[model samples]
Every structure is written in structure tokens, then in C-alpha cells.
Target: MLVELLLAAIVLVLLALVLWLLTTTRRELGELRQATAPADAVTELLRRQIEAVRAEGRDGQEAVRREVSDLALRMRGDIGGLQQSVASELKGVSTEVTHQLHEGMKLIQNAQTTMGDRLDRAAQVVAEVQGSLGKLGEATLRVVEVGKDIQGLEQILKSPKVRGGLGETLLAELLSQMLPQEHYTLQHPFKSGERVDAALRIGDRLVAVDAKFPLENFRRMLDEGEEDKRRPVRRQFVRDVRTRIDEIAKKYILPDEGTFDFALMYVPAENVYYEIIIKDETDLADDPIATYALSKRVVPVSPNSFYAYLQVIILGLRGLKIEANAQNILNDLARLAGDLDKVREPLRTLGRHIGNAQSQFTEAERALDRFGAKLETIERKGGAQAELPEVGS
Candidate 1:
């Protein structure tokens, strides 16, 4: 646009210069005619100069036109190349954007797959936890039921008869576990018309056990708070235990019925056993319950101590049986030794008779061989072969 405007201004300036030159030449021609000397030559020279200026202006206008056209063509080519380069760059940018979008989609899909697997595993873990919680709930219910049963048993144990029964049951259970059936008897009756709780048979001897425990006063003594009150209850408790021991001694220790000189008094409750033993240890020897019981041949035993005693008795019985078997074995061996001595001479005589019979048989065989050789020689001399003595003869 600027080049076109510049060419138009140059053409306008050239036209204005030609018009000014024509005006100046016409005035000079008029002046020369007025003067009338060389007016025609000057006018001809002015005409030639005006024609040269017009041609030069024409050439300049053509050159300016050519320059304007070339500039327009170059600007168009530059604008086209710039448009193509921009289009190619835009295409590359679009391809890269498409590739990036595809990669982003793939990443999102992979993330979704990983999240799904993790959620499935978490659900499995939750199910397992729920199952374990169910099992734990059942175990808690069982524990509550067991607690109720224990409370009920405790209430039952407070009765005197129930306590006595429990003691006897415990004693019986210990006997069953520690002794063979033949070695023990339950509720064994003595000649004194008293039925003992249990008895152990050691060889031909019997050892009675009494399971009845006098626990009423002992319980009262334990429950009382005042020292003065507890002292009387304790003394009464000790007296009751002493009386029970005397009764057991009088009834169960029957030497005439094959019982041992002493009897056993089993106290099933460990606390009661310890109380009596502790009293005996701390009290005066003359008034000691243990000493008094021992004097009457009534021995006090706790569950653990009685078990130990039973083990010793079982061992003693096994030793006695082993001793008897060993004695019988020795007797049998002695009898076998005597019988072998009696048969020794007969075996020697039988061996000598067999040796003599073998020697006689050997001599008869040698005689038979010589007779055979003599018969063959006679047959060769042409003589009638004499009848050889029969081998049997």
C-alpha cells in the first residue's frame, strides 16, 4: 500500500514540473518574438529539453512500477511460506496432544484395576474378622455359663451333708486313681459295726480311711471377726476334730479283723488340713491335736499326703509280689538241677552200647569181601564153583 502511494506522488511531481517548464518556455517565446532576433532556435532547444524530461519521467515511472510489482510478489510468497510452516507446527502439536490423551487414559484404567483388587482383598479381610468375632462371642457365652455353674456348686458345698459327701467322693476318686481294684474297698465294715469310708488292702492287712470332716465350727471360727469370739469357736472346732479322730480310732483300728494298728483320717479340704497341722505345730505338745491323734492310732492325712502314702503302699505290694515270684523261680531252678543229676549216668551207659554195636557191624563186612574174592579164583581154574556159604548164614 505505501509503495503504491509513493509512485502516485512521484508521478504528480513530474507532471507539475512539466507544466512549470511549458509555462516558462511560452513566456520566453513571447519575449523572443518581441525582441525578433533568434526566437525560433531557442524555442526548438526548449522543445528538445522538454521531450527529454518527459522520456526520463516515463522511464522512472516504469522502473517504479516494476519495483512495486516485485515487492508485492515477494510479500505474497513470504506470507504463503509463513502460513505453511504454521500449519505444519499446528499438526505436530495436535498429534502430540492425541498421544498424551491416550497415555492418560491408559494410566487411569490401570489405576482403576489396582483399586478394584485392593478393595476385594479388604472385603475378604473384613469377612474373616467377622467370623473371628462370632467365635469370640460364643466363647464369651460359654465362659459366662461356666461361671454360673461354679456359683451353684459353691452354694451346694455349704451344706454339712453335701460337704461330707464331697469329701468321701474325693477320697474315693483318689483311691480309684492310685490303687488297683483288688487292693482297695469302699465302705468297708469293721467288726465294731462301724463302716469306714475306704480301706486299702496291703497284703493280708487292712488300713481304714475316714472321710467325714467336722467343719461347722471351723467355718464359724473363720467367719467370726472378734478375736474373743473366734477363740471359743476355734477351741470348739479343735474339740470336734479331736472327738472325730477318737471315734475313728475306736471303730476302724481293729487288729482282730486284720486291720493295721493305725487308721487314716483324710481331710479333703486343704485349708482344714493346714489349720489342724498349724495348730499342732504351734500348740503345747501335751495338748497338741496331732499328738493326741497319734496316741490313739488315728493318723490325719490331706489329699496330697494321702496320695503319697498310697503310692508307698502300692510300691510295697509290688515289692512283695516280686519277692514271692523270685522265691518260686529259685525253687523251680533247684528242682531242675536235681532232676538233671539223676539222669546223668543213664545217658553215659546208652552212649557206650551204641559204640560196641558199630564195631561188630564193621567186622562182618570185611569177612564178606574175602569170601567173594575166593569164589572168583575157583571159577577160573575150571573146577565147579563150590557153593559159597550164604551171606545170610
Candidate 2:
């Protein structure tokens, strides 16, 4: 548009210049005609110059119009091609963007599905955890009840008399399970007018067992936390055990009273027994406490060890009973042999009588055969006599 406007301005300026030149030439021609005869030739020459200028101006105008038209056509053609190229590029971009959006939507849907599945699994896990927590609560309640029962038992065991009775009861139960009624005696009195916890009869002797043991110091030793605090309590516990052993040995182990040389000190609790019988590395031969008890002729026994002792005693009793019966069985067999000797002569006499009877019977059979032969001879003679009579007739 600027180029067209400039061209139009140039054409207008050329036309104005040409009109001014023509106006100047006509004034000169009029002036020349009044001044001289050569004015006609000058006017003719000025008119030809003016016509040539006009022709040249028209050709320039035509050339300018042709160039403007060519430029406008080229611009239109370039604009149309550019518009088509832009449209093609826009279509391709739109298709690519739509494909990308479709893929993005699919990815989002897959992600949502995966998230939903994960959420479901998480919910299930939460439910399982809740159930486990409920079970844990129930177990905790049960543990609390058990702990309370244990505390009550601890309180009951604090009394020395109750503890003594409990030990005796446990001892009696073990004796009853392992031995016959006649084999064991509970609270068997001694000649000193004192009674032992129990006595087991072995052959002609008795094994005295005492169940009353001191446990207070032992319990304290276990309950004390620091080693320094436990040291004195442990020493006291050992002394108490040794004292109990000495007392049992003095009271129960009486050889004159048919009691065994050694007596049993029954400990009802395995842990307490372990404490009494534990050995240090320096006491390699045996446990020091156990050795001390042995030296006093009192043997410490826990429930388990006492049970084993009873089993061995039962087997020994059975062997003794068998041994006693064996002698009686031999005596009875000897008497049976004498009785057999007494019957031997009678049986021999009966056999002689039977032999004599068989001989007589054989002789009687021979006599019967001789009688039958005589009868046959008589019959034959009778038949011959009958035949002679018939011939005479």
C-alpha cells in the first residue's frame, strides 16, 4: 500500500509539472508572436517538445502501473501458499495433540484402577491388624488374671505352718502313688515320743523322711536383687538347710529303732532344692551343701529325685518279696516230692494185680478152644450113625 501511494504521488507530481511547463510555453509563444516572425517556428518546436514529454510521461505511468500489478499478483500468490502451509501445519499439530490427550487419559485410568486395588488391599490389612489387636487384648486380660493368681499363691506360701503342711501333703501324695499302704507309714512315731513325716518299710528296716524344711531365708535370697544383699541371705539359706539336715539326722536316723542309717529331707520345690544342692567350680567332687547333708547322714531330695528314690525302693521291695517266696516255693516242691514217693508203692502193687489177671484170662481162652473141638467130633460121629440106620432100613 505504501508503494502504491508513492507511485500515485509521483504520477500526480509529473502531471502537475507537465501542466506548468505547457502553461509557460504558451505564454512564451504569445510573447514571441508579438515580437518577431520566428515565433511561429518556436511555438511549433515547443508543441513537439511538449507532446514528446507527454508521451514519455504516459509510458512511464504505464510502466509504473504494470510493475504495481505484478507486485500485487505475486503478493497474493505468496499469501495463498502461506495460508495453505499454515493450515496443514495446524491440522498436523491438532492430530498430534489429540493423540497425546488420548494416551494421557488411558494412563490416568490405569493409575486410578491401580490406586483403587492398592486401597482395597490396605483396607484388608487394616482389618487384619484390628483383629490381631483384639486377640492381643484378650491374651493380656488372661495374663493379668494369671498374675493375680500367682500373687495370691505367693501370699499363701508366706506362712511357715502353711508351707510345712503343703510340703507334707506333697510328700504323702508321692508316697501313696508309689507304694502300697502297708509299705509306707505317715507320721510314724519314734521311741522318743516324736513323729516323723513318713517312713518307708524296706525289708526289716525303715527309711525316715522329713518334709518340714526352712524356706524363709531361701526365698529372701532369691528375692534380693543385688549380689551383696543376696550374699548374706544365701549364706543364711545354706546354714538353715544344714541345720535342718542335722536335725533330721539326729531325730530320724536311729539304727536301734529299725530306721535306716540315712534319713531323707524332702524339699517340695525343685528351685529351692536346686539352690541347696548347687555346686561351685571349686567344689568339683560334689555340691558343698549336698556333701554337708550327706556327712550329717541326711540326704536332700526334691520331688523329682524323691520320686526316683521311691521307684527304686519299690523295685527292691518286689525283689525281697520274690526272694522270700522263693524259699517257700522250694519247700512246697519238696513236700510234693515226698507225697509222690508215698503213692509210688501203691501204684506198683496195682500193676502186679493187673498182670496176674491178664495171665488167667489167657488160660481160660485156651480151655474154651479145646471144648469146641470135642463138640465138633461128637457131631460128626452122630451123622455117621444116622447114615448107617438109613442103609439098614
Candidate 3:
């Protein structure tokens, strides 16, 4: 891989000189510094040259490490996972390089001990060492330049100039649209004593969500100032993040001032969260540092988390819809029950009248049967009187 990278550098420097600033600088510095300085001993100069190249190589490696780590924080899905894997592999490479550097240090000490009496030869050796250092310096510069190419793309994606970020804005939009307009509300200023990212409501319950992140620090650490300067800024960046958490809690988490329940300290950048808590020395237990501080329960959502929460909220909304429909159905059933009661009273009165008419018809038929029996008895008595008179004669 190093051999291929070296060959690529040669083509880029010779044919396409636009991206080969290091090669050009090396050539110019050589031409300018060309002189026969007989006063300076070559061996010591060579040793100094070697040290300088090694220092530059170390710088280049550190820069590359920071660039890759920052990239891991910005990307999502498989790209993010790949970035993480590459960062770990780079760290492994650094450990191996450190071992090699120690070996080189031992070799330098041996050379210095053996060549104590050879000043003229040492001066020539120094010249040769200077030549090697120059090449190594060129190599270091090439590595840094390639790191720059990749880091530039990372910077563009993480920048918050476009009404915050794609991830944050998308999260805010979804929360705003999910809840009913009357039930839940959304606000955006983003937790710097300025904007609240999003707000949600259900019944009398209210919550504020703020997406606060400092993405520029890692890039600045990659590209800017000395270590003494850089370390302090990085520390302050983490401290400022705590201050922002405090600000978000104080400004947005008022139970009586409209936000009920508790507020959400949304970290739209999940990678940033991992960098701070998992990679850095900070812990969740000590994150807030105050009783009223934004709780660790403050939502840490990735793009996936937001979508998942949305799915749950939709289920709740569907439940509410079902409840409303059931209430309407119950009201209709009550109205039908009242109408049925009125019809039932009229049917009962009609049944009573039918019973009275049937009883009167039965009494009239009994009276007619009694009159027929009386007539039949009278005919039988007349026939018996006629038979008795005939026997006496």
C-alpha cells in the first residue's frame, strides 16, 4: 500500500503538479540551500535531519488519525461502520510504527557510539542523512495532503450552516407533523439560550427537544494550532457542550411555563454522543452534574431512533382514533334506544284492546247455545202426550 501510494505521488508530482506542493517545495528548498558548508559536521547534521523527518511523520500520522475519527462521527449506516474499522486499523498501524521508531532510536545510538573519532567521515554521513530526511519529509507532506482531500468532504456534510443539519432538521420536521396541531407543538432555536429544536404535546403533557452538538471542534483539532493550544480548545469544546446541556434544561424545561412532564435533550448526532461518552472520559452518571439538569434520559436519537419513535407515536394516534369512533357509535346507540321505548308503549296498549274484544265474542256464542237447547226439550214433550192418548182408547 505504501509502495502504491509512493508511485501515485510520483505521477501526481511529475505530470500533474497541481496537488504536489510538497514535491515542489522540496525541489525549491534544495536548490536554494545548495552550498558546501565545511564548518558543519555531516554526521550530526544527518542525525538532526533524521529527527526532523521522524517528527514530521509523527505529525502526519496524528493528523490522519483525527481526520478519520471525525469522519466516523459524521457518516451513517455501513459508511460509518467502515470509518470506525479504518480508525481502529490506523491506531494499530500507529502502535507498530512506534515500535519501529524505538528500534531506529537504538540504531542511531549505536552509530553515534562507534563513530566517535571520525569527524570528516561523520560530515559526509550527515550530508547523506540530510538527503534521506528530505525524502521522508516529502513523504510526510504527501500523506497530510491526502488526509486533507478526505477531511474536506467530511467537513461539508457536518457543517451546520444549512438551518442546522440534514439529520437534525429531518428529526424536527417529523415530530412537528406527527402530533395533532392542538395537542403537540414544535420549536427550533437549538439549545444555546436561543432556539428549542422541537416540542411535543399530548393532552396536558408537554416536552421540549433540543439538538445541541459541536461538530467543528474535531475538524479544527485536525487542521489548526499547536498541541498545547489544541488540547485546551478540545477540553473547552466538551465543557461548552455541558454548558449547552444546562442552558437547554433551564430554558426549555419549565413544567408550568407550558412544557409539562420533562424536556428532551436531543442529540441528532449519535456519533457525537459516542465520541463524548464512549471514547472520551465523560460518563452518563456525571453528565448533567445537577439535580435539575437535563436527565440522562434526555433522548439520544439517531436517524433510526427518530423513525422508531415515530412508529410508536403513530400507534398511539391510531388508538385515540379508535376511541373517538367508539364514542360516536355509543351516542348513536343511545338515540336508537330512546326511539324504541316510544314504539314499545304503543304496542303494549294495542295488545290489551285485542284481548277485551275476544272475551266479548265468547260470551255471545254461549247465549245462542242455551236458546237452542230449550226449543229441543219442548218438541220431545209434545210427542210423548200424543202416544199416551192413543193407548187409553
Candidate 4:
């Protein structure tokens, strides 16, 4: 387009030069024609020169106009092409922006929905916690009443709810659901014999888990405010826990019964377990009273550690699945063998009885053979006797 404009400008300048020359040439020719006498030859030559200049100027002007028109047409085409290219580029950019806006709006909406769901969950959790708090108040009242009732019974020499009796049983039942039924065997004295709270059977060894932690003493620790007044009671409670672990090890874990390869003092209460683990004393070995062993090692496990133990049990159960499968195959083989023996015994006995009966029948078969020979002899005699009877007739 720029080239076309430049060419048009050049053509217009040439045409202006041609028009000026043509006018000057015509004026010169008129002057030359009017002049006469001996200067006529000079006037005639000037007239011919003016005529040639006029003809050449007219041809140049025509050519210049044609070139200007072509250049103008080419410039118009170039401008139209540039306008189309600009329009298409703008349209593409606008379309891309619109697409991005839609995507951004979708992401915003998704984020809003996710935030709303999380808020709803938080509200639900708050409601549930409020309900739980109310229930906990009622449970506290029941426990107080139960403790008073048991104490009243104990005064009368009946011993209502002892620590190792009903409490351990209830706690064991709660523990059983989280654990394998076979791996954890309930050992409350309902079956007689020196039983444990629960026995976790691991291979040939047993982890005798006794649920015996003085919750009452721990509760006193929680209840006590003054450190000076609380210290003596707190010290006694520590001693009580140490004693409890030792007593459980001696009572529940009988090495004679293969009870304690290592025993577990299963505290279902996390706080109680943490208290013992965190609670230090003069007799404590590693961390606190929990890790401190009595006979061999009584590993104290709270709810969390017990869960870890349960996970171990789950993996153990998976391994035991293979043992169970092998056991089932062995049981099936034994049953098959027993059934085959049952069938085979009857068949063997029947064969023996048949042999005995055959012995009894051998004499009878021989006697019958002798009787048949005597009968043949009688037949021959009868023929001989028939001729004598004919003579007598």
C-alpha cells in the first residue's frame, strides 16, 4: 500500500509538469506564426519545436493519469485486506477471554460448594458434641449412684461391684469387639480356675491382659486441686498402680499355665494409660510406672497402643487364615479317613464271619457227598434185585 501511494504521488507530479510545458509550448507557437520577413525560417523552426513539445507533453500526461489510477486501486485493496486481518484477531482474543471466564466461574462455584459441605459438617459435629455432653452428665450421676450402692453393699459384707469383678468384665466385652474373638479369650472367673481378664493367644505364648487400673485413685488425682493436699494421695495412687501391675502379673499371669510370656495391662481409658506412662515415681525404670516391669515385663497399653496391638492381631489373623485353611484340609482328610475306616471295618468283619461260617459248612457239604454215594449203590442193587423179583413172579 505504501509503494502504491508513492507511485501515485510520482505520477501526479509528472502530469503537473506536462500541463505546464503544453501551455508554454502553445504560447511560443502562436508568437512564432505571427512574426514575418527574413526571420520566418527562425520562426518556422520555433513553431515545429513547440508542436513537438505539445505532442510529447499530451502523451506523458495520459500515461501519468493511467499509472495514478492503477496505484490508487492497488492501495484500496491493501487497506481492505489489513482491516479483515485486524477484525479476525480481535474476534479470536474475545472468544478466548469468554472461554476463560466460563472456566473461572465453574471453579468458583465448585469452591463454594466444597466450603459449604465442610461448614455443614462442622455444624453437625458441634450438635453431636452438645448431645454427648448431656449424656456424659447423666453417666456421671449413674456412676456415682452405682459407687454408693456398691459401697453400701460392701459394708454389709456382700461385696457388690468389686474392681476386678464387674468392671473388668464390662471393659473386656468392649475390648472384644475391637479384637479377634480367638486371639483374645475372655478369662473372667465364670468358668472357674485361676482365670485372667483376657488372654491374647499368640502362637504357643499368651499375653495375659488384665484390666485392673484403679480408676477411683486416678479420679481422685483429677478431682484434687491443691498440690500440697493432693501430693500424699497422689503418691499413694502411684504406689497403688505399681502394686496393681505387680498383683495382676502374679494373679492373672501364671507361668505354670503358660500365661505371661509377656502380659498386657489393658487400660481401655486413654487418660488412665497416659497418666501411668507420664506419671513418674522412685520405682519407675524407663518412662514411668507403665513400662516398669514386675516379674518379666507387664507392658501397659492404653486405647491407642491396644489399637496398635489389635492391628498386629489383624495381621496375625491373616497369617492364621493360612493355618486355618491348612487345619480345615487336615480336618477334612481325618473325617474322610474315619469314614473309610468305618466302611472298611464292617466289610472286614463280614468277611471274617463268612470264613467262620464256611468252616461250619464244610462238614455238612462232605456228609451230603457221602450220602449221595450210598444212594448210587442202592440204585445199582435195585436193578440187580429187579431180575430176582421177575423170577419170583
Which candidate number would show the highest lDDT if scored against the true structure? 2
Question: Which candidate do you rate higher for TM-score, 1 or 3?
Answer: 1
lDDT of 4 by residue, 1-393 (tens): 576668867976896787778777777666655764447777678768877787777777777767677767777778788778888888998899999999999999999999999999999999999889989999999999999997885555333246446547655766677766767677644233667777777666567777756766666777789977677776777878778777776676666666655677777577776666765543433345744554447777776787788788778877888898999999999999999999998999999999999987998899999999999999999989887745456
Q: Which pairs clash in the backbone of model 2?
A: none
Which is better, 2 or 4, measured by lDDT? 2
**TM-score for each predicted model, relative to the true structure:** 0.54, 0.60, 0.43, 0.40
Candidate 4 residue 366 Cα shift, in angstroms, is: 63
> How many residue pairs of model 1 clash at the backbone?
0
lDDT of each: 0.84, 0.86, 0.63, 0.73
Looking at model 4, how many pairs of residues clash? 0
TM-score head-to-head 1 vs 2, winner: 2
The reply for model 3, stretches above 4 Å from the true place, is: 1-168, 173-195, 218-234, 277-280, 283-297, 354-393
lDDT for model 4 comes to 0.73
lDDT of 3 by residue, 232-318 (tens): 666665776667666666777676655654565555566665555446643344443333233633454455566677677668767
